[model samples]
Target: MSAREPLIVQREVKPLDFLAAGETASEFKELLKSLGIPTDICRRASIVTYEAEMNTVIHGGGGVMSLRLEDDAIIIVAEDQGPGIADLEKAMQEGYSTAPDFVREMGFGAGMGLPNIKKYSDKLEIDTRVGEGTTLRAYIFIKGQREE
Candidate 1:
């Protein structure tokens, strides 16, 4: 199938589950392929999804990620109930992480999580409130028009 085909898949997952991260990534890849997403674009989408999932697990304390596949775009919404980000601008900067020491020991606390998500996604929107939670919505276009 090609990206022009009509196919959509959606899934909800709990945060911090051991299987949540890898499972979500694999499902996203399969869904993209099933929907006729090009291989290259699927790879990019998978990467972004994985990063978002990880954030939901490690930072959000727990949350849900929902994905929608459209003929020309992929939309992912990741929500979490952890401490909200204090500074969105600073968080978007590369190499600024707040991961705890344990996560750092796992070799993923370099603070590049949010930056990487922004880098791989075509459009990113984050909504967060202190002591409330956070929600991240990202969009990736399959055959979107480019401005001159």
Candidate 2:
């Protein structure tokens, strides 16, 4: 196998699916812990994953979250078929939410999802097409070196 080939694993997040929601991110966090990743890095990764998963569940309509484990970093990719973000800039702002009132009632749609993800990820990129879909790629360096 190529050295660059990732050790790939993934999980699906479905809307209103209580049984499996957020499980993927949780498992990813545990895997990172087992691999001896630093506490801070692991926590950041876990938080990012959860936020991304919530976005997928609440906004994406449903999607898949994948983890690509590389020697130097862990990559998170969240892809969904939900309506693409209409305003990327607005969505990035803290406390800006498009989630319905019911989701907010659950104390989850505080509008911190993208902001928190960006804060914790070493690198963040988003690809979205309104009425088509959205994809988010987040990188977390595991080498104890934070990117400036």
Per-prediction tally of clashes: 1, 0
| RMSD over all Cα atoms, model 2 | 3.1
Q: In order, what is each prediction's RMSD in angstroms?
A: 5.0, 3.1
| Candidate 1 residue lDDT tens string, 42-114 | 7777888888888888888877777766656787778778899998888888888888888888777588878
lDDT, model 2, position 11: 84
Off by over 4 Å in 2: 1-5
What is the C-alpha lDDT profile of model 2 across 1-148, one tens digit per residue?
1124375677878876544656777788888888888878878888888898889988998898887787788888888989999999999999999989988887878999999999999989899999998999888998867753
Model 1: worst 10 consecutive residues (lDDT sum): 1-10
Score every model by TM-score: 0.85, 0.89
Model 1 misplacement above 4 A: 1-15, 145-148
